[model samples]
Target chain A: MNHDAYPDSYIRGILNSVKTIAMVGISPNTSRPSYFVFKYLLGRGYRMIPVNPGQAGKDILGQAFYAKLSDIPEPIDMVDIFRASEHVMPIVQEALTLKPKPQVIWMQLTIRDDAAALLAEQAGIKVVMNRCPKIEYGRLSTEISWIGVNSRTLSSKRAQILGKGVQRMGLGTPKD
Target chain B: MADAERVPGFATLAIHAGAKPDPTTGARITPIYQTASFVFDDVDHAASLFGLQAFGNIYTRIGNPTCAVLEERVAALEGGTAGLAVASGHAAQVVVMHALMTPGDEFVASKKLYGGSINQFNHSYKNFGWNVVWADPDDIASFEKAMTPKTKAIFIESIANPGGVITDIEAVSKIARKAGVPLIVDNTLATPYLCKPFDYGANIVVHSLTKFLGGHGNSIGGMIVDGGNFNWTRKGQYPMLSEPRPEYSGIVLAETFGNFAFAIACRVLGLRDLGPALSPFNAFLIINGIETLPLRMQRHSDNALAVSEWLSKRPEVLWVSYPGLAGDKYNALAKKYVPKGCGAVFTFGLKGGHEAGVKLVSNVKLFSHLANIGDTRSLIIHPASTTHKQLSDAQKVQAGAGPDVVRLSIGLEDKDDIIADLEEGLTAA
Candidate 1:
């Protein structure tokens, strides 16, 4: 995928397909963006496995923390990097060692590692750098539109009325 | 470089969160997006937007750029995941209830609430078949007893209106958690500057932006903030959040939007159908009002404390009921939750009774005789004759609007002038 200007479909496909996310560098601190993103994905029905060496045995929002990606018992669908750009290469390298290796590596906002991206792609993994999954999901699902953010996608179709009660974020139901 | 991960402070967030300089004009302040509808790029784009596949401004009533900034700013201030701005404080209440309750669902609410909310709940909500079980906020056990299987939410005001009674939010929150219901705190009296309900485990926060948040009496608005904590999908209690939504191709809001789903539910389901969209112009004014919230709130608290102290000593006054007063019953709770001070609004009683209450309101000079609170100018009201006139005598007293009670919304005025004006009102009474 082109890092500079990836098409919307590329992002939509990744968001729709991913089920479980491994958030490396997840913090216990509630104010941290990583913690917010981790909590967000968990609420959105995505299973989250937190990875932080310092908080290895501790729990975050009741989810047990893992010391490393390899410590996770199940195969991760995506590895979301919340660490500094300098730390991405090690995380990507470690992620590649999983038995049923992850399909995607997503870096949080303002974090990009071109060398790590190339390595991950060469090993048959898709990479998204300097982007946020929480934001992408909200934008693609039209949830962001409620707050008038210019999501840059529009359609002529009127919002289909679900029932007599309230309609939801235009985003479709999560497929198991 | 180390500053990359630093979260901005409250003062910084109040000014810059959810906003950036306009790319086109480099406008320092957010410009009002006044147009009714936005132009779509093509047929595909339009289809995507309506289908909820893409996000963009489609119509002002549904969403506006100006209102979006205000929503984000308030959400950030309240430590919430998301926020929805509505036409008035009452509209916000309606939207929140509309999202949480279907016909026949019940919610537990604190008796110490604004008279308008009590009326809205007791009458308007009953019409919709949403039953409200009123409980005393002072007794945590009262909230626990009010809970039933049908209870979907627990509602309370932080630093309640009229009496300035500080609620024990954390204790009530425990009951909500055990009952598997969301705790909704109306933070109108104590803005986020004084107390962020989210910090004490509130699942949602509602505000009448018409009050201190707008700071001035110029605009009327309200907001609902999703704390993003409650598990809406648990036990399938809240179908609005857990069940598949038919409108957007059976999309489940709780499963898609995560922590922010409740706010989205309010927007797409309630605001869209209810048609209580906040005007972009009013959004603009309120956004500007929020920029000085910290400064104004501190001064408001300071001035209110002084006035409360002065009133306690007056022989004409039967009692003063500001939580910020050291010996007030709610003073300890105020110290715990609203340590910044118990906000600027409070009520007092006259020794001369109902006739004196009416005369005191009439005699005040610098203080405006008005129904609104949280204005820059001091405001006084005899609620029994005005806001609570419709309620029966017993109901009026229960809502802290007794015949002899007078409410004052202290302003950011010279403390001496405010005291002198009240002195004049007392002498006349």
Candidate 2:
């Protein structure tokens, strides 16, 4: 599903503000889509919260890796998972139980379970099937740099990317 | 200590721990005499009653048989030498602080604490010339750095509010002991089951009976428990305890009451003068709440653990901040101190920041959006917009609250149902 599918500014506005998200399950081994998608999201400035309990408690891309979601104590807003369908159940349960429950639960690029989705949906929790928060953040809110021209215009003309507009953000807000 | 003596198991002692069927009247349940004045046998008996020569109740306001039983029960629950029941938790603080420090003394406190404490320290106490020094508990040196000759006590919450961060009570208590001061802990968040502050080297423990202790959310009251650990007569430190009380005809509290009785002195003298006595009705409600505390606390912990686990996996979730979660920074501390169970109140961030945060709050059906914590029913609140709204952006961040932050006081609900309601809120967020 793309951003324009819902005209409700509520969901759209949310999708716009979120950028780099730490997908807890990004695999360093390139065979995994998590690795490629993670690279793409990192290239998009969204931080990933690593959650491979084994490889967690280490560092990835100079960012501290956590064994689980709760390990990253400072600040984290979104959790994108690349685990399994059954795995999503416990993950969803844990996520809703968070002090501030996550804004959206996207069930990866292929793994979709209506039962899990409905559970999250019932909690007034948002769910996206077969979608990635990293990819969406990159695609929906792209005021991209480089190539010197308007990326939104370029993506519209060349790739037909379906977002509204690009406004420069996260830069130069302070004054002396 | 014997098995039966080790705090007398919560339920058994909450009712029978303090009173033993008043010998004068073999009544089954404790009774309130309700009389303001007590008759003396003769003029010598009257002099002794007022002059500390007799051990009988003379006036209801000064001392009551019913209030004494309530005090004993609270003291047993807290595992302190004695306990004092006050008009409110705020009053308990006032009374205790008055007993420990004089007009120009100071106390140190943690930065991540209740907002009311910050206000009381900065505003109300300032008028009374009592100074409060803020220290970052995370940086142990800040506490030591803030200490001075005038410093009298080190204050902290066993578990902080809203943030759910646990203080290293033993470590802070050590610092206080080294500095010749008492460690005062607000045990409101952790409650007695989750943590016994007295057991962790705290010299005094205070509680707002409004929260978890009164489990059913029925009353407003406060209690103060003296650990009977601090020695007031050792040196020329505490003037109030070592010296004389002018109103009580020059009676030194430490000399008159000995160890366990200083807490009672704070009641008979301090609370009596300050006039912040707890009502019998509130005490009754608190007693009712204390009976099922263990059961309710267990349910609250289990539900919170389930909710925290679900929150970590959601795509739209920004971050989850509960200590029970494996990777959480506080997880190790939780295991060390709160091994039995971590309380349910905690905070998490929404994926979409503010708009999503609003959606999250508006979406949840089962989670009530209210300000109070430790309720049987689950409640949620947005910190940046509500409770800490008065603080500046920097202050909000200092208080560990962000614009996107949502606090959930998970209640005794089915785990799946709680998650289901959270899902709806996350969708809205």
Q: List runs of model 1 lying over 4 Å from the truth.
A: A1-104, A107-176, B1-4
Q: What is the DockQ of candidate 2?
A: 0.00
Most accurate candidate by TM-score = 1
Error of 2 at B130 (Å): 1.0
Docking level for model 2: incorrect
Across all candidates, the chain A TM-score values are 0.90, 0.67
**Candidate 2 local lDDT, B99-148, one digit each (tens):** 88777889999988877777888899987789999998678788988999
- Interface RMSD list for the candidates: 13.9, 37.9
lDDT of 2 by residue, A19-81 (tens): 535576766554344654555455435665667777866676566777777666755566677
Q: Candidate 2 regions off by >4 Å?
A: A1-176, B1-7, B22-46, B58-60
DockQ of each: 0.07, 0.00
Every candidate's CA RMSD: 11.8, 32.1
TM-score of 2: 0.67
What TM-score, computed on C-alpha atoms, does each candidate reach?
Answer: 0.76, 0.67
